[model samples]
Target: MKLTVHTFASLDGVMQGPGSPEEDPSGGFDRGGWVVPFMEEDFGRVVDSWFARTTELLFGRTTYDLMAGYWPQVTDPDDAVAAVLNGSPKHLVSMTVTAPSWANTVSVIADDVAGRVRELTNRPGGELQVHGSWRLVQALHEAGLVDEYRIIEFPVVVGEGKRIFRDGATASSFDVVETQVLGSGAVYRVLRPTPFTRGAFSVEDGRETVALDV
Candidate 1:
């Protein structure tokens, strides 16, 4: 299984709550629902594309709770996102959530979460996707487990909120697999992690010399 992460963020990288104002208010974050104004057909199409590859869903407690409370109620058979989310197998990572009420919950991983997720990846499947789980995404990133990132960067500068790439994150680089700018000024980016690189530029013989360690 390929571990993939899907998320929505502001230009400033805030990914706290893109859905509603009351979605995630942790840390006094009042700048929720920033992605709403920019939502358009393009955004839906991009997100649907992500869901198309999802064979399983991996989520942190908060995101899982939010999704479970909402998506199951969306009993629209024609809705592709709701269908995929409600039907796919799910893995929740949390010590507090002992009994998940969501349908098709495979396991609740508390200890050795990275190890468990690695085990899941070793299994044969299409894509085990993590959506709106910033904290879990960070842990998986640190463990070098995320295979791809599908991000929709909205054109808004949320002054204060939880960011996707928090401070003191592991230094890394990504290979841009694809990029598309919507008419709403939102940018959809597909990125794959690459080895972190370092480089330096200097002037030699009046010409520029570049040195890089890949």
Candidate 2:
């Protein structure tokens, strides 16, 4: 199973909340629906594409709770996102959530979460997708587990909110494999993580040149 992350972020990398103002108010995040305005048909199509490859789901406690509160209520058969989320096998990473109320919650990893997830990746599946699970995403990133990132970057700069790559996050680079421009000025990007690289601009033989550190 390839671990993939799907998220909506602002231009400033804020991924706190993109659905509704009441979605995530953690740490007094007032700018919750920054990505709402940018959600057009193109955006919906991209989101649908993510679910098309989802065989399982990974979630942090908070994100799982948030999704459970909403997705289960959306019983629309035509809603691709809701259908996949409500029906897929979900793995929750939490100590407090001993028994999840959500249907199809197969397992909960309280201890040895990274190891458990590593084992999950070895299972037969297409994509074990993670959505809106910022904290879990951070841990997976640090564990070098995430295979790809599908992000929709809205053209909004949230002054302050929880960012995807917050300060002191695992320093890694990404190779942008795919990109698309939505009608609402949002950019959808698919990135594969890569090792962090460094380079320096120096004056060599009276010419400015870039010296890449190997």
Candidate 3:
């Protein structure tokens, strides 16, 4: 089982609420639903393909609360998007949430989220996917537990908002796996982590030589 993270962000790196104005306003963010109008069929196809390969989902408390409040009551039961979301197994990480109201949901409030997530990744499954949890994503990244990243970079730029990448976050490199351009000008990029190659340095005759081995 591999843990993958999927998220959308503005060109300026804002990952604040992309659905509704009231979804998140911690930083007085007014441009909440900025990603909807730009959504295209090509993007939808990309999401569908990605979800089809995922076996489970991980979400933060805020995102879980928001999604639980809406996705279950979606009027279009036949909609493919709703079906996938409603059917996936979800693990919500929170210290304050005593009970989860959503169906097919579980609560994981341990102090070591990275350890638990790594344990989950070692289990038998297709893919454990994380969505819309910037904080949690950063933690997992720092723990070096994320296997792949699917990022959709929108063309718009919001000068200030909650960003996907934060200061002092872990430094990890990736290899591009897939890239596509949506009709609405969003760029979809998929990346997989590559093994780190350590370099050796040797000094001889007052000169230094470096060699890298993978």
Every candidate's CA RMSD: 1.1, 1.0, 4.1
lDDT of 2 by residue, 16-54 (tens): 978889999999988787777777899888888999999
Cα lDDT tens digits, model 1, 1-214, are 9999999988888899888889999998887888888988888889889999989999999999999999999998899999999999999999998999999999999999999999999999999999988889999999999999999898889888877777998989999999999879998999999989999999999999999992
92 Cα displacement, candidate 3 (Å): 1.0
Q: How well does model 2 score by local distance difference test? A: 0.91
Alpha carbon RMSD to native, model 3: 4.1
Model 1 misses residue 39 by how many Å? Answer: 0.8
Candidate 3 lDDT score at position 186: 95
The list of candidate 2 runs beyond 4 A from truth reads none
Question: Candidate 1: which stretches are off by over 4 Å?
Answer: none
The ten-residue window of minimal lDDT in model 1 covers: 157-166
Superposition TM-score, candidate 2 onto the true structure? 0.97
| Best prediction by lDDT | 1
- TM-score on alpha carbons, each prediction: 0.97, 0.97, 0.87
The all-Cα superposition gives candidate 1 an RMSD in Å to the true structure of: 1.1
1-214 in candidate 3: lDDT tens per residue? 8999998999998888887788888777888988988988998898888888878889988888888899899869667767777888888889888778988885565567987888788989999998888889888887888889999999999789888779877655679999989999899999887765577899989899887873
